[model samples]
Target: MFKGLGGLGDMTKMLSAAKEMQSKMAQLQEEMDNMTVTGEAGAGMVKATANAKGKVKALDIAPSIFSAQDKEVVEDLILAAISNAQDKAQAKAAEEMQKMAAEMGLPADMKLPF
Candidate 1:
């Protein structure tokens, strides 16, 4: 054991922690990519599904809502559902980040680079 290399021990610990954090963040990113959330509008007649990254994965429209004269209404409902899904995705991402920070012993209020 090199007694003069005392500072190296601390540096090694810091490096290990940094590597661990990086690995956890990457895993979290992958999880978010596969995690899906759904939003609906018009009393669930219209539904939208999006991943935590806010990418729209699917949309569903009730056949009864299809009408030639109500085209604009259908369009609005679709937009509303998409917007709701995006908002929820954003919130869910934030929650996941916070959880990771907490587990890493960082301050809950600390913002993580995602």
Candidate 2:
């Protein structure tokens, strides 16, 4: 419909693409908030759960790993589990973005605004 204008057509197309992308991004954000990843350490003795946005949601520790002398070790394990959970969450988020980009006919490796 934007026939007479030269660059205006391209601009219009860009604007349409931008709006679509914005809508997709909002949906993705909501999905990420609901998506979860779990990370474990010490042979699954400690587990940390995080959302795809890398927010730690909860943690579980096995009773066997609890000992007064090993308090520091337990703390370390908890930290490691949390870090692993965050890493997994980030990877998951990236994978989701890649999937969306692919669906949009964009480069699968394109860095989406997350």
Candidate 3:
């Protein structure tokens, strides 16, 4: 139908692709928010959960690790667990983004606007 308008057909296709990409990105964001990862430290004495966006959601500490004299150790374990969780979240997010890019015929390394 756009034959009379030079390049209009191409422009229309581009626009449609852009819109589809936008929608897919939005859906990916939502999925990332819901996806979670768990990380552990201190030989599983401490555990932390975070979403793909790197937001910590919960933490768990084995009661046995808690001691009046080892308070500093407990604190360190918690920090380590949290750091691990955040790292895993970041990795998962990147993996999902790469997968989405691949599915959309984009370069796997392309940095998408989140």
Candidate 4:
């Protein structure tokens, strides 16, 4: 409605769009916290679940993998599962962000702050 304000109109429009995008981003962040991915290692002897935000939620280890002499092997499997879970979480987060950007009419490759 700033018809007579010249450039102010464009600035106002830009600010409004930015505000809307910020709101959408916040909502997406909340969604990511609830979204989860699972990763496994050592032929599924160890598994880790993490949220899209890269926070580990739960871990599962096969009882057969637990042994006194194989302690180090079990530890390695746990670490590998955790790392895989984190990697998947990061990829999922990026995919979600790209989808969001596309929905917002922005370039799919446009990176948004995580």
lDDT of 4 by residue, 16-67 (tens): 9999899999999999999999989999989999999999999999998888
Model 4 residue 18 lDDT score: 92
Which scores greater on TM-score, model 1 or model 3?
A: 3
Q: lDDT score, residue 39, model 2?
A: 94
* Model 3, position 44: C-alpha lDDT score: 94
lDDT-sorted candidate list, best first: 2, 1, 4, 3
Misplaced by over 4 Å in model 1 are 1-5
Candidate 2, which ten residues in sequence have the lowest lDDT sum? 1-10
Candidate 4 C-alpha error for residue 56, in Å: 0.4
Candidate 2 residues lying further than 4 Å off, grouped into runs, are 1-4
- Which of 1 and 3 is the better model by lDDT? 1
* lDDT of the structure predicted as candidate 3: 0.92
Ranking by TM-score: 4, 2, 3, 1
TM-scores for all candidates? 0.90, 0.92, 0.92, 0.93
Model 2 scores a C-alpha lDDT of 0.94
- Considering summed lDDT, which 10 consecutive residues are worst modelled in model 3? 105-114
- List runs of model 4 lying over 4 Å from the truth: 1-4
lDDT score for residue 94 of model 1: 91
Provide the clashing-pair count of each candidate structure: 0, 0, 0, 0
